[model samples]
Target: MSIIAVVTALALSIIPTGDTPTVSVQQGAVQGVQAEGVAAFKGIPYAAPPVGPLRWRPPQPVQPWSETRAADHVGAICIQPPANGDNAVGPGPMSEDCLTLNVFAPEGATEPLPVMFWVHGGGYVNGSGTADLYDGSNLARHGVVVVTINYRLGRHGFFDHPALAAERPAEEPAGNYGVMDMIAALKWVHANIGRFGGDASDVTIFGESAGGVAVSQLMLAPDARGLFAKAIIQSGVPQGATSRLDIATPSGPPLADRGASFAALKGVPADGTAEALRAIPAEAFLDPAPNFGGGDLVIADGRIVPTSIEDGFARGLQAPVPLIIGTNSNEFPWARADTHPMAQALTPEERTALIAAYDDADDFQGRFISDVMFNGPARWLARQHAARGHPVYLYSFDAWPDAMPQPHRGAWHAQERQYVFDTLSTSPWPTTARDEAVAKVASDYWATFARTGVPAAAGQPAWPALAEGHEEALVFHNDGVAVEAVPNAARLDLIAALLDRLKAAGLR
Candidate 1:
């Protein structure tokens, strides 16, 4: 049936159905579920599918339809593997018809709601906004319009070619299509959110892991200016994390050469790369033989992503907006150590040796992973925003064993998702009575931050704006909120220097 028909029928069915009053928007209408103080609409399409010839090009406006598209079900994820995290969500369906988003807002017939655009994290290769971890219901319950979006991923989204660019001189550089998708979503929000009771002027863009990197990089994109009023960076920093084809210079294997690699694959053709990749089964593409390790997809396209975010932020170039950021105390243990039971049970000798190898290294090897993977980037973001004379809040999730599920060494990568959303049942983290209380506190703070510029809460400790040298940030732990300076500051500084040099060398 036509989407118009579906929407009309849906609208007809909503004749005073208890609480959730079905509403209409420019494209069509939706009957959202309402509870407490929030009204939610899931699977809303903000842009047209960039399929066939439109592939690799910038996003276009949503198709003008006579009827509303049925957004009850999430749109298919960009043609990529499903999330296989420590909690692997098995492979599911795929489609080019994947540009869709979801939203939650406080129920009110009129007036604009503050916007919180959420970007999910999956290392830029795996994951979707449809995941349970990003449920915007509770957040909307806190009084802002919360949105989660799915963008292109992996080979389908990041493949770049000089031929492709030449074919479309009007377009941005090919890789970072996923990032372009996000900019498109923000634009969509800017254009149509008011009809849904959202304030386009108060948008706060935020995300975790790769998503955090996306928000950070978006700061550098000229096109993203003024789309958001604030930013909440989680675990990502834009450093050497560029698309293979997007790098202007490189020192890796022969494969790093854009000309050479494309020349070698010339027989295959560029536009057809997507088809070739699709022809290969999902499992095979998950990891190729020589193993480049899931193939990083967020390349440094010259157009949408003009420069590296790390350099951009450090040069006083990030979006001048209020910012909030931080990471769990021991996120690596989840990404690395948690995968191995024995590793988590590090013997005294192992712990000592591990600490020795890392304890003194500038920022330690683990610190590099933590910083690049999630922390330092966050700190850098907080600093840049504060420098902009905006109120920037920095935090550290130190809830440790009390917040995590299973015996954990400390706060792990995804451990905060559940807490921030007050969702512990679904996340893999160990949850205790303390965990529940902590999660409530965490979610409450995030909601309050998104609602107003302040992350204040009732009976909760006051979070202070970040001050340079005075690196004091909020530490959310079982002991309740406390103020603590960013630990290992000197070590992180050393790690940053080493990484700058290594990235300069391009892994040679």
Candidate 2:
């Protein structure tokens, strides 16, 4: 068959059949499949495919389709580094045309339910919303609509070159294209989620790791104002601010300089035009990819990411929305307690007191790094947000998998994801009765928070909001849950002091 005929046939096959759930979004009508009391619409295009000349540009409006497009299976994920042995890969093959989102809502619900928009984490280099671990059926059944999105990743998602900027000429912000994709997705949800039985006004943006960082970014972006009502940051950074767009930061060179350096490595001429840069194959950018281990994933482009997350919150410029933020107890169990840049700012007495506070020398490094990097920052952000008169709830995740047996020191990074999504069945480690129980409690807390402003779970302890005098968090462990004062206050205080010193010295 000819190319046009083949395309027509495939499009016709996707037309809604009898009993298939259909919803009319602004772009067009879509047919979704229903199972287990949930209506799942997959591979829904929210923005135009970023390909060829459109590459590196802000997401454009999705072209309207005349026929009802099939929303049964997932679309291709954005081009990213291969996972090798990692299991966090998304559902489809990798491609540049991957700006779609997935929606899961309770089937046949009359009233509009709360909307929970999720952003996946992969160090800003990998990951997609279509990962099995993010299956939203269970969470949707809890009386909420769940939406997960795929943004630009790696160079395809974030890049800044003087030539590229000149082409746009003060149009959209340069760099931070992935973040722009996110805001476009949000605008789509705000406009069309109601047709899917979701309350657009009650949307909550939640994410893990880099995704959590994005939640904070959206809270700071001026274009994202009033897009969401609540925010949750799971394992997000509170101190490590991102690099500036045109200006150098303590972290590294400005994004424009980095982009030029990358272009030089790619053999682009000093006076190369934007067309020459765009002509380079996408795969070429991956062979000698920019160091993925460090922090250049997103940039503080003045238009999109107006300021660093820490600076935004510090300046009280972030949206005064309800917040839930926390980190895992043992985010890095293998980190050795050794010299650090921040440690250089500590005095001998202060360093001794900090070490003595953690108690166990064998696990000193793990606990210390966790406190300074994750726990302490989480508490600090919580305090800042709470001080703004907005409701804030904090928590610590300390549960271990059965595979990692006792004297458990590993709540390791991102371990709470399975529990928060109630996706223990998809866990790589063998789960026990306690694991399932913890998943229920953890997922309940999250879904409950999305449903209402406060988090509450049946048969579990009430989660308290952070206040001036009383600061407590809902601690999730293997056995059960508890609400206690934020753990290791002295250690966190020392970490904070050291970090403040580092910032003062222009090293952070």
Per-model TM-score versus the true fold: 0.81, 0.93
- After superposing all C-alphas onto the true structure, candidate 2 shows an RMSD in angstroms of 6.2
1-508, model 2: which lDDT tens digit per residue? 3332233334332333344688778899998888878888999999999988889888999999999899988889888877774555666588898999999888756556789999998888888998878989888888889999999988888787888877885666778889999999999998788777777778899999889888988899899998888999999876333667778866567776777778887888656888888888877766645553426768777778877888899889898899999999888777655765666666788677777777766657667777777888889889999999999999999997878755545798889998888888777778899999998888888989998989999999999999888889999989999999988777788777877777797776
Residue pairs clashing, model 2: 337-365
Per-residue error for 377 in candidate 2, Å, reads 0.7
Model 1 alpha-carbon drift over 4 Å, by segment: 1-20, 85-92, 170-173, 240-296, 334-368, 371-373, 400-408, 493-508
In candidate 2, clashing pairs total 1
User: Which TM-score value belongs to model 1?
Assistant: 0.81
Runs with alpha carbons beyond 4 Å of true place in candidate 2: 1-19, 240-242, 292-294, 405-409, 505-507
Candidate 2 lDDT score relative to the true structure: 0.83
Model 1, 1-508: lDDT tens digits are 3332233334333323335545566667766666676666777877788776666666777766666455555656666553546342222456667788887766642445678898877766677777667777776766677888988776556655544655556534565677889999999887667655677777889887777778888877888998998888776655544444534434343223442254334344434444443344434434432223223445555667766676677677777877888887767743442333333444466445544545553324334356445676667667777776878888888774443355445776766776776656666645678777887788778878876888887797788888766778889877688877786566456545545655475541
